[model samples]
Target chain A: MAVIGVALVRLRDLFGVVMLSGLFTLTAASLYVVMDAVDVAFTEAAVGAGIATVLMLETLALTTGREKVTRRRSLAPFLMVVVTGAVLIYGTLDMPRYGDPGAPIHQHVAPRYIEESGREVGVPNIVTSVLASYRGYDTLGEVTVIFTATAGVLALIGRSRRTRRRKGSQTTGGDQDAR
Target chain B: MRGNIILRVASKLLIPCILLFALYVQFHGDFGPGGGFQAGVIFGSAFILYALIVNIESARRAVPAVVSRVALALGLLLYAGVGVAGMFLGGRYLNYSVLAEVPTTGQHLGITLIELGVGITVAAAMITVFYVFAGEER
Candidate 1:
């Protein structure tokens, strides 16, 4: 995965960069499976590795495959990235160790969910019970967010106009930049 | 891509299985490690694969853009409607205890319906995103 990330940064071809990022997501999905978060793995594999890659490839088809070379180097963006990375790494130092039973998370409402979810929701998978029932309002919010995304996309560049103007001369020469 | 017989045949064979697995994940979520979100993405990707292998026009014809647009709203409505139904039945918003004769049964029914709603909306949203991206002609 680290190698893929390095390759992604080194490759100037937008196509190769997209493929490498997809590979990175696939690797992360496998890591999630190894950590016993199969539900997360499923989502990462399907959304991150699958649909995102395809959408990015389609975007690439509409633009140039090669990234433009910038004559001037920008140090501010690089410094900002390094500083953010450092801060994130420093922040994780205070986090509880992975799967620590005495962690604050385990001492909270998680115990009740783990113990009583089966009786309360009557489902074998506690994750599903929690997501669909216990956190039903959250899921509803998530669904609304997705709906909003679709609406935004539709408003921006959805239905094609070419379908309606079928009889026009086909020499418009790519002026369909809806914006 | 149309000239690549291997890619064409393999995708034809794989797409159905992907769709079937998506349905399995949706219905069997309560017993396994999958659910509406994962199932929806998987389902959307099946159609996306078809679009990638064939062409965007035919894929749109197979599943019209209007259908997905409507589904996008319908899914959210289904989820919110369930919540309203709970309120009407004398429970708090999104509370499933009053959805049926028994609390646990109500919970089960509520979860399944809401999950279905999530799946439908998610699948529609993904397909819509793909269509919007691919519809732009170069």
Candidate 2:
């Protein structure tokens, strides 16, 4: 992962950067798998590595392939990154140790979900029970957020006149023939 | 493209497999460590793959923005509707136990429905975002 990060920084070619970022995501997914978070691993793999890479490649198709190197360097960004990392590390100092059974999180409602989900939710998968039943409101909110994002994207760039014209000229059942 | 017959043929073979896996992930989520979010991204990537091979315009025609738009809202509605139904059944918001006569069965029905809703919304949102971003020049 560090190697990929170094390669990403050293390579000015935007395509290489995108590819490396995908590699980075895959690494993160692997790390999640090692931590036994299969669902999260799946999400990171599918979203971070798969769809994001394709979207970036599509963006690359419309833009320059290589990055423009700046002659001047800014220390502000580097300092900001260092400060942020330090603060995050500091914040983690108070976090419970990994997988401690006595941790507050484990002592909370998680135990009830784990113990009673089979009888209550009748779902063999505790994770699903928690996500869809115990915390259905959060899932609803997440769906709504996705809907809003789609709406925003549609409003912003869903229609492109050049695409419409080219599409109209191409085939009988093209875009313009309908709208 | 080099009229890349290999890319075309391989994609044709792979697209079906990808879509099948996406469906598998969606339906099989309750039993294992899969769900709507991951399945939806995979589903969206299938279309993105098609767009990569052909063009965004053709992909758009195949999917159509209107379908995505409707799906986006419909999924959210289904989720919230389940909660509303719970209320109508004299339970608290999102109390799936009231969804059916049998509490366990109601849970199964509620979770399945809501998961399906999540799957639909996530897939639609992802596909729509890809279309907008990869559509054309500003």
Candidate 3:
């Protein structure tokens, strides 16, 4: 499945690439849902399927359809992947079973959020209370990140109209001289 | 594109429901697994759908670029203002218990205001992102 996904991403067609990316996001969201992380799944669906796919399609619109050939060797990426995979495997050796009742995560600060957050925050959604209230500074930083990205997008793609206007004025000058 | 009946009809029916659901999720998040982030995404998705079905220019006309920028800034200000309010009431930064004279329940009121701020910022940001991306096609 991974190989097929990679192949789809490598396909020359821009639409195909966007579709493949959506598929990859859906698969990741499914995994999250299966792991009982419904909130994470919801976010992955929204950001991955909804926003990222649209952004990629928009990017393709601003560029040539053809994929450029890379001359760089693959050894660095390959070694990095291997090392990361090894570390992930090593870390998983001592991990608790999926949905285990005794998992440390369930026994810790998480439970406090689940149990007492409603009374303290008057919000039923513990995730929101935690994200916006308990850790509001982090959420503020996240909003800043989004704000920066919005500015960057505007800077990059928002210049086309000015260039077009300049060309239009130049053509008008030529027409005036001809008359 | 303006004459596409299918897209126009579908979006008309879907957009309202999406916005309503976004609001429901925003307020009902305490019991469920949703909050500002999820609600913002849903709200943005509705606008994105509108942009997709209708013309991008028309969508822009409906939601001007300047309005989105203001919405983004306003959300951040609302959030910071709540925290500052808390500080003035003699608590630490963002310490919700100081927001009210009542000792026990002030934290709850502060949290609600903060969540509102998050929801606003997130929704505006998401819509702005969609607008920037959708605008590229033209």
Candidate 4:
């Protein structure tokens, strides 16, 4: 994954970058499976490795595949990234170890959910019960957010009757649709 | 792409399986590690594969823009309606215990319905976003 990240940063070809990123996501999904998080792995595999790659490729088709060369060498952004990484790493120092049984989360409401969810929800998969039932409001919020995002995309680029009239004319591009 | 017999035949074989697996994920989420979100993406990708292999116009014809647009709203309405239904059933918003004679049964029914709603919305959203992006041209 680290090697892929380096390659992604170095590769000027957007197509190769997209492919490598897909590979990286696939690797992450496999790792999630190894960690016994099959639900997350399924999502990463479907969304990250599958649809995201297709979407990026479609975006590439609309734009240029080769990234433009920039001669400017400003180190401020790089320094900022390094500083932010350091701060994030420092933040993780206080976090519990991976899968720690005595972690705060394990001692919190999770215990009640695990112990009582079967009786309360009668679902074999605790994750589903929690997501669809216990966290119903959160899921609703998430759906609303997705709906809003799709609406924004529709408003911006969705084909309208006015735009339909100008179909097959590549020179007009997307700007004419704003009118 | 038009003349690639291998691509054409292979996709025809795989698309149905992809769609079937998506439905399995959607309905089998309770006993498995899949759910509406994953199922929805997988479902959308099947049509997306069809679009990528064939053409956008044919894909649009297969799933018209108006249909998807309505589905996008309908799914959300279904979810929200479920919540409102709970309120009307002498329970709090999104409370499923009162949805049926048996509390667990109600929970089960509510979960299934809400998951279905989520799956529909997500699938429509994915398809709509793709249609919009793929509609663009240089």
Query: lDDT by residue for model 3 over A6-50, one digit each (tens)?
Result: 778569877887878888888889999998888899889888988
| DockQ of every candidate | 0.88, 0.71, 0.55, 0.90
Q: Could you tell me the lDDT of residue B88 within candidate 2?
A: 97
Interface RMSD, every prediction, one decimal place: 0.9, 1.4, 2.5, 0.7
lDDT of 4 by residue, A1-179 (tens): 99998899999999999999999999999999999999999999999999999999989999889999898999999999999999999999999999999999899889999999999999999999999999999999998998999999998778664566666354466456433
For candidate 4, chain B by itself scores a TM value of 0.98
List ranges where model 1 is wrong by over 4 Å.
A160-179
Q: For model 1, how does the per-residue alpha-carbon lDDT over A93-125 read when each residue is reduced to its tens digit? A: 999999999999899899999999988888999
2 against 4, candidate with superior DockQ: 4
In model 1, chain B matches the true chain B with a TM-score of 0.97
DockQ ranking from best candidate downward: 4, 1, 2, 3
Enumerate the chain B TM-scores of all models.
Answer: 0.97, 0.93, 0.88, 0.98
Sort order, TM-score high to low: 4, 1, 2, 3
Better of 3 and 4 by TM-score: 4
User: Which docking category, incorrect, acceptable, medium or high, applies to candidate 2?
Assistant: medium
Residue B33 miss distance in model 4 (angstroms): 0.5
* Tens digits of lDDT, candidate 2, A107-179: 9899999989989988887888898899988888888888887788777667655666887878698664724
Error at A175, model 1, angstroms: 5.4
In lDDT terms, which candidate is top? Answer: 4
Model 4 misplaced regions, further than 4 Å: A161-163, A166-179
Extract clashing residue pairs from model 3.
A124-B30, A124-B31, A125-B29, A125-B30
Return the lDDT, model 3, position B9: 93
TM-score per candidate, chains pooled: 0.93, 0.90, 0.84, 0.95
What CAPRI grade goes to candidate 4? high
